[model samples]
Target: MKAWQITTPESGLRLAELPDPELRGGGATLDVLAVQIPAYTADLVAGGRGGFPLPIVLGAAGIGRVTATADDVFGVRQGDIAVATGLFRSGRAAEPEEALLGWTGIGGDGRPTPTTDRMRDVWRDGLCAERALQPERTLLALPGAETYKATEQLAFLPWLGIAGAGIERAEVRAGQTVAIVGATGQLGSAAVLVALARGAAAVVAIGRNRDALDALAGLDPRVIPVALTGDRGVDGPAILAAAGPVDAVIDTLGAAPTPEPTMSAYQAIRTDGRWVLVGGVRQDLPIPYGDFMHRRLTLRGSWMCSDSTILDLWSMVRTGVLDLSLLDIQIVGLDDPAAALTAASHRHGLEIVVLMP
Candidate 1:
């Protein structure tokens, strides 16, 4: 089997012919169809985002058909189409810690752990190959997925699951207005569709790209795009003006050197409204304790999604409540990961990049 391997953080990705993965107890092997290289893959590979012990395949989310499964695995059977998000449970679902399949992605605290080598044997490999191994718990069956002619869209389920879980965590109810920061990106776009599907009276799409924001607004009349001015004080008012006082805000902006944009979103929230952080913004936020206490604002953080969350998202897609057709997907081959990574980094609007193994 051919796989893309990174020997070290500084070493670039190379296509290597590797031995097929051995099926472990309670595990399944997937004939990988398509894998999406996240926008942050390049940064992760180049050591800009700390280092991971290398000599590993690099990919997180993908959709594939089950070719083999251990006798103990019953969640999915041979020939079933499944989605893998690179997340798996070790001890129990109720346990505080979980294992991410690709890199040292995220752990118990819903944050990436500093120890890059923890679970190195399990997470050292990912879905960037012809076939990949995963615990049965990480595979979710996607019945009739082929009929949709939306393999690219199906590749986004991992992100949709994450965004959906965050929206759920915020307790966004029907007939309420919701704001999605960084709405032009993949996760943000998913949140917008989920909010609309869940019956949000209005969905505010906030981002720095005017054209992308405009494209999102074109998807639904209820979508209101608020272009960021990069100034917290100014952007806050802009968001409020467009969406009015939102009932909740889901921030999907990636790691930022400063927290101004996130803070700007914070200011747009109404009193008692919830602000959920699901993105990679790395800076520490300085919240006014007195203001938070008086306004009764609730701040929460959501990392990855659960299996139940994935099922809910799949149901929405199957029922056509969450339209996957709106996304513009770009597909590439595994031979050109650098080009794929470059394209991923410039992601905008509903454009998503998928790698075909």
Candidate 2:
């Protein structure tokens, strides 16, 4: 089987021919058709900033067809199309050769066991190969969707998680105004869609790139694209003021100092409004507790959603509420995951790329 392998953090990944995995007693194997790349996340893994294991197949999401199955209870069957999410049992837990192997959960009998963890790892491995062994937990049968690309459909994993977390943290409700900082990246753009889908009255898309901002304008008349000409820290307050008093703020810019957006979040947001931090902005900076206390603002953080949240996202996709086609996506081959990762790290492109098997 042809796959990408990250030999070491410093050495990086390469396309190699590896052994194909076999179906376990209670597992299934999918013939991978497509894989998507969140270039930004991939770069982090290559640089060792992201915590993926070495020698692991590099992918976050994908689509495949089940070719074989050892268990009928898993809801996936041979010849069924499926989409995979990679957030479960990651790192040492998801390593195929590791004890956990990505499957970790309690049994139906209400007893905790290692069986669950191993099953999850098998699911993660299935995403990056021509043929893959997928656990029941990670595979979702796509009964109706017609086309699948590594970059486009694969985006459901990261972007969907971002949108879910941002909306939850912001406590978005109908008629509320929401602002998405860095609203052009994989997570940021998804934030905009989530805001719209959830019925936010106004969604402000803020970014440093004019082209990206312009790109999002057509997606919705409600999306107001604001540009950051200067540093975010230097220009954040003014930008927020221009956008008006938003009820919620979704900050996805993962940078140091985080700009002074907290001030914008404080001044523009309603007294009870929340500020959701999805990126690593100002991670090292101290928060102004005085201002936070005075404004009575809510500050929250969001990581990838729980396993169930991911499943809900799939349902959203099914309903056609989350339009992933609006996202920038490029498809590549499995052997070329490195190039996609390199581009994502630098925030180089307006689109996300998916690696196909």
Worst 10 residues of 1 by lDDT: 111-120
Tens-place lDDT digits, model 1, residues 202-316: 9999998888898899998999999888888899998889868899999999777789988887777899999999988888898999998888999998988888898888989
Give the runs in model 2 whose Cα sits over 4 Å from its true position: 72-75, 89-126, 146-151, 229-234, 255-266, 343-350
Model 2, span 37-59: residue lDDT tens: 55455535546232433456655
lDDT of 2 at 41: 56
Mark the 10 consecutive residues where model 2 has the least summed lDDT: 98-107
Quote each prediction's TM-score. Answer: 0.94, 0.79
lDDT of each: 0.84, 0.63
What would you estimate as the lDDT of candidate 2?
A: 0.63
Each candidate's number of clashing pairs is 1, 18
